[model samples]
Target: MNWALTNYERLLDLVWQHTWISGSAIALGFALALPVGWAAYAMKSSPHGAVRQLSGVTVSLSSVLYTIPSLPLFVIMPTILGLGWLNPINVLIALVIYAFAIMVRGVVDALNAVPPSVLDSAAACGFSRGQRAISVTLPLAGPVMLAALRVVSVSTVSLLSIGALVGVSNLGSLFTNGFNRNFPTEILTGVVLTVALALVFDLLLVAAGRLLMPWNSVVSAGGSA
Candidate 1:
């Protein structure tokens, strides 16, 4: 408590750094995943044998990316991306890769969960593929996507701390510093702050989802009643 209070400004800076890295990675990953997931989902049903294989290939590759060890990935990012070892972008890039790998599958599942009957109705109503995707399918998949985003948000927040291992400063630095100095308070503060940050992100995501999908709230209320 004494150290934290004395170093309050430094703690706040690290928290800000952690927030930016996690938030940017999640946002970028979600943006990239949407179209790729749609492509993979659409390709699954293609008449061409090779085209249909694309969906499986895409998902398998994403899973493989997720399986790669994060520490090594962080260390290698500088060499791979031509950034300096200490550059913050190294952490950002590594985090983005991880976020994308996790979110792509979620996007595919969300899209697949949309009812076929609803898609057919959209088609019958003369909606083009793009129109149906944007207007009907996406709205229907909102809850599932929201669930995925929440997961990504929390996971990214938790994961970003690893960046500190490679000289990239974030909340994880506290852990390393505390361990070196044999100070439990610093380590506890890091753990508590990390957990609290993840929870805040999750709550914000839930609030945003409810605000954007009032019908989902109504359905839940009706189900409970």
Candidate 2:
């Protein structure tokens, strides 16, 4: 307990490091998920059932990755990628994969929620399929997409704690070190700070969503009835 108060600098450093690790993972996840989501949305509108089915299968496979133990995934990745322990890149890769299914599913659902008549009207106005997607669909789906991003961000923040198992030091390392040394205060500090970070990020996402998708407020107001 005394050590915990005295190690304030170390605690602060760990928190900052964890935030970067979590942020990087979420950024990577979004970069990878966005195109896949758009592809899935396009496939959903296709006449062929097979294409839609394939999209579903891919999402399902990604979801399965989440069920696997984080430590095992961390251990396996270095061997698979030939990057040994303490590699943040492997942790990032695992987190991105873990995030993929949720993001893609959210995107598809958001796109589907867009009114079909709006899409048809866009086509009637001489917009091509790509144009309709870029303009009509994505614009209408902005709020839902933002919601998905929020979820992914919070999830990645919490999961980064597991990255410490493979020596990717962060807030998780604080908990790991504290626990091994039987330092209860340090362990509690890590837990509290991580939760606080998640809450702060969630609020930031909500604010950003409101700013980016003001129409969502209108939709929400109307739906309250």
Candidate 3:
């Protein structure tokens, strides 16, 4: 207890840094994923085989990106981009790439989950494809999309620890430092704090999702029937 209190500032600093690293990575991932998802959703309705092919190709590429080893990805980026150690930009880029496939898939799945009858109703009511997508499809798909985002958020938080391998001073750095020094107390502290932070963020996201898309609750309640 005494030791932990003394190290409180260090722990707080680690938490803040980790938050920044993970948050930036997830934000960039979402930015890239949203457009890819939108494109995939659009392709589903198009008669063009090329559009479907393109969506498949994009998903596959992103999956490949996710499979690349994280440490190697960090190491290779500095060499290729000439960004030295602990480059946040490179870290963010790699994290984004790592997360892209899940986000895209989430978007695609969410869009697909909308009922055919709802889509037909929209069409009958004179809703254009674009209007239906924005007003109806996306809204209906909100729960699934939020679920996907939750998964991505948790993933990003956990993986951000890997950034410490390349000298990024996040929570992972604290863990690494403690481990390298053979300090059990430090290691335990890092593990506990990181897990706590992850849980807090996860709960916050759940709350936000519920608030943003109350309709999801209705859908979920009906689905059990």
lDDT, residue 26, candidate 3: 75
Q: Write the per-residue lDDT of candidate 3 for residues 43-149, one digit (tens) a residue.
A: 76679898888877877777777788888988787777788777777777777777776898888888888899999999999999899878998788888888888
- How many clashes (backbone atoms < 3 Å, residues ≥3 apart in a chain or on different chains) does model 3 have? 0
TM-score per candidate, chains pooled: 0.95, 0.89, 0.92
Ten-residue stretch with the least lDDT total in model 2: 216-225
The residue-by-residue lDDT of candidate 2 on 1-225, one tens digit each, is 577679878888888888877887777777787888878777765789999788777677767767887789888988888887777888878888777767877777888788889888889999997887777788898888878888998888888898887888888887888889998877788888899999988898889878877777764534555
TM-score of candidate 3 against the unseen true structure: 0.92
**Candidate 2 Cα deviation (angstroms), residue 172:** 0.9
Best by TM-score: 1
The reply for model 1, stretches above 4 Å from the true place, is: 220-225
Better of 1 and 3 by TM-score: 1
Q: How close is candidate 1 to the true structure, as a TM-score?
A: 0.95
Evaluation by lDDT, superior candidate among 1 and 2:
1
Screening candidate 1 with a backbone cut-off below 3 angstroms (N, C-alpha, C), the clashing residue pairs are: none
Cα lDDT tens digits, model 1, 1-225, are 888899999999999999998899999989998888889999999999999998999988997898989889999999999988999899898888888898889889999999999899999999998999899998888899889888889888988888889989999999889899999999999999999999999999999998988888773434544
Off by over 4 Å in 2: 1-5, 219-225
**Which candidate do you rate higher for TM-score, 2 or 3?**
3
